[model samples]
Target: MTSPHVAALRSVALNVPDPDLAAEFYTEVWNLAVADRQDGAVYLRGTGPAHHLLALHPGEQTEIRNVTFRARSADALPVLAERTVGAGGRVLRPVAPVTEPGGGVALIIADQDGRIFRFVHGDAEHDVDTAAVPDRPVRLAHVVLNSHDVSRSQAFFERALGFTLSDRTRMMAFLRCGSDHHCVAFGDSDRDSLNHIAFLMPDLESVMRGGGRMKDAGYPVGWGPGRHGPGNNAFNYFVGPFGVVIEYTAEVLQVDDSYPTGGPEDWTWPPGRIDQWGIGQPPTPAIKEAQQAIRFMPAAAF
Candidate 1:
């Protein structure tokens, strides 16, 4: 069995038409700081370090098509880079990091679906952007993907990219690439693009306040302020800058060797179940067995 690589999501590159507006939205609504701008790309991130977490690469595509992760070290980069190409995955770009003030390195690669992922080597601690009242963005969380082939997606992530299974729901599989329950998720669907990118907040209170703050900023709640039955995470999703779906969540499901591996990664939100806290509300509609569109389900407070 190929061992799963321990990698951390570093940054996600989004192709946008308006860099300025996208940059402002991320910094303001998401509470990530504008790290810097290159020719046409703008990078924004929370305070831990690395300078940025999301970079807006102005383009015609409105959704997020590329994702990146930071490897354990520079040494790991070359090995994975070689394995990726050997596995028939195209190396859209060579293994190299863009120069930044923080002094980190990154390499970009494309997944089976042609989604670009920039891999990096560095550990910069994220600091809260205090300019505006910092919403509790505890850490960069997971990203969900709608893929044409779940097996291919799973193979690429597990075989070459290095990720482990954290949980599942019929066709949706959550993977833990490092410490979190799932840094990335794959769902069998007709469309190919990022489903959502999540950030961990401190608590439900912060999540509601952040949602209100974002709404006040004009970005209405795209979804949530609900908990997920699958991951047990308190969640909120909103339309973020660069045509991306952004999430603010806390206490998602987590695992390690102790977590049982194998079996269909299936978990489900029982029909009409709303709020993980078990408050009275309407039930969420059932998702297509595998559709390309994004679906929103708020967890009932159990």
Candidate 2:
């Protein structure tokens, strides 16, 4: 059998204790517009075409509900279902039509690793009005997963989904389905958790401007305003509502099939200052503790 062909990182759903606060943080701070909202959930959209890039659902604590991905086509859904079964992924729900913000069909499935995956097809697109929205993000860049065994998670994603290895460092691995260096990555951890969710900024100036905006609103950079070694992306990070680490990144290295896949520790790019300008640092001890103090969000919140 072949791997499931995924195109883009659709949206990430989080079951946060305070959906209202979480919703406000993304809307007011990140500049994501409130696409829609009901009693227990709120959908947020960037200046891009997809319905909502983030979903905040009511829960007891802050935890990821699911990560949604876009498949190549309507027919691709059946192929994904079949391949998922063969790989021990149970289909939480079979394929069905959906007419939500992004009109399309979607289904819930989970791999053996316990990560819930939702796949969508035929979703309506959005045309960002840049002149009207100055704070809009370019797109959802990538999400880093903290896994029990990074290798196991990496292999499952590569072989089960059509994700290719974009790069690897001593402690992390970047996987990509498209040219933008990586749409998903994995980091070493004792339990499954989220490392961070990144949003693509238009340019370096936007990153600084956005960071300043966050600072003005009382959220400071937990880490970043740095340059990474693998993807060569300039990054600035902050802790959002529910203690979730969010990042604004620009100039993410792009790669195609010909991009050399290196051996262990054979990263393509040379080591540079964590901050290209030779300044900035990683998350502080307090921020690290807050991230490590994640509370569980149950699988079934409906």
Candidate 3:
């Protein structure tokens, strides 16, 4: 069988208390456009045609349901499922046609901390945005997860999906499936949950405009308006419902096969390692707490 490999981040699914309210926050404040809806679940897309980048489903609590990754080919899904199961990860759901709005075959697996991951192929791409002044994201950038055992989690990503480690910090790992700095990352945490989800803008101007739109909609910026040390992307963080963090980021660094990777010791720490502009206070207690918080209990089946 061919080795399974991921191509890019496809989408994120969240289980929150009120899907309608959360959907509004995403569509109105965050600027994502709805692609489809069924059975109280909403699929939202960005500027490009990659179907959707976020999915909201009904639930009493709020927490990540799954982080979805796009495979290079439909044939890759079975390979991913086989290798993941062979490597001791649990197949929360077998490979099958996704019943959700976006048509595709998806495999759901539980990572080291039992966080769900959905690897999908052959999803329908939606119509492109034609807004007069679209501020919707150019694409879904990356997802950061709080891991109970980061090393273990990182290993699974590398082994099962052929993800390359771009950089490793004492408390964070940057991994990539394609050229982008990272499509998935893990932050050291006592428990499992989402750290944040980032989406790309064409340039710094779009990032600022998007943030301004969010702020005008009553979602104040929680952090950023600065560049980061690793990917060197400009960022603006806003807290969404159920304390889910969303970032409007632009101009992320890219790498090819020849680019060298680094570990914590090799990184340039301090002097705005997290924030190159040296702006904004350090992460607040709420931010720290949210990193490890479990906002929703995963359903027994996918």
Which candidate should be chosen as best, given lDDT against the real structure? 3
What digit string (tens of lDDT, one per residue) describes model 2 on residues 1-302?
12347888978888888888888889888888888877678988887777888888888778888888899888888877777777777787789986456668987787776678889998877777557454468679998878878887888777667688877776788898888888899887787888888998888888888988999999988887787777889888888887888889888998887888655556433474444555787678856766555533444532
Q: What TM-score quantifies how close candidate 3 is to the native fold?
A: 0.93
TM-scores for every predicted model: 0.82, 0.91, 0.93
How many backbone clashes can be found in candidate 3?
A: 1
lDDT of 3: 0.80
For residue 259, give model 2's deviation from the true position in Å: 0.6
**TM-score of predicted model 1?**
0.82
Residue 5, model 3: lDDT of 74
When sorted by lDDT, best at the front, the candidate numbers are 3, 2, 1
Point out the worst 10-residue segment of candidate 3 by lDDT: 293-302
Q: Residue 80's C-alpha lDDT in candidate 1?
A: 76
> What are the clash counts of all predictions, listed in order?
32, 1, 1
Given candidate 2, what's the lDDT at residue 242?
77
Residue 85 local lDDT, model 1: 80
**Candidate 3 stretches greater than 4 Å from native:** 1-4, 130-134, 271-273, 299-301
What 10-residue stretch in candidate 1 is worst by lDDT? 293-302
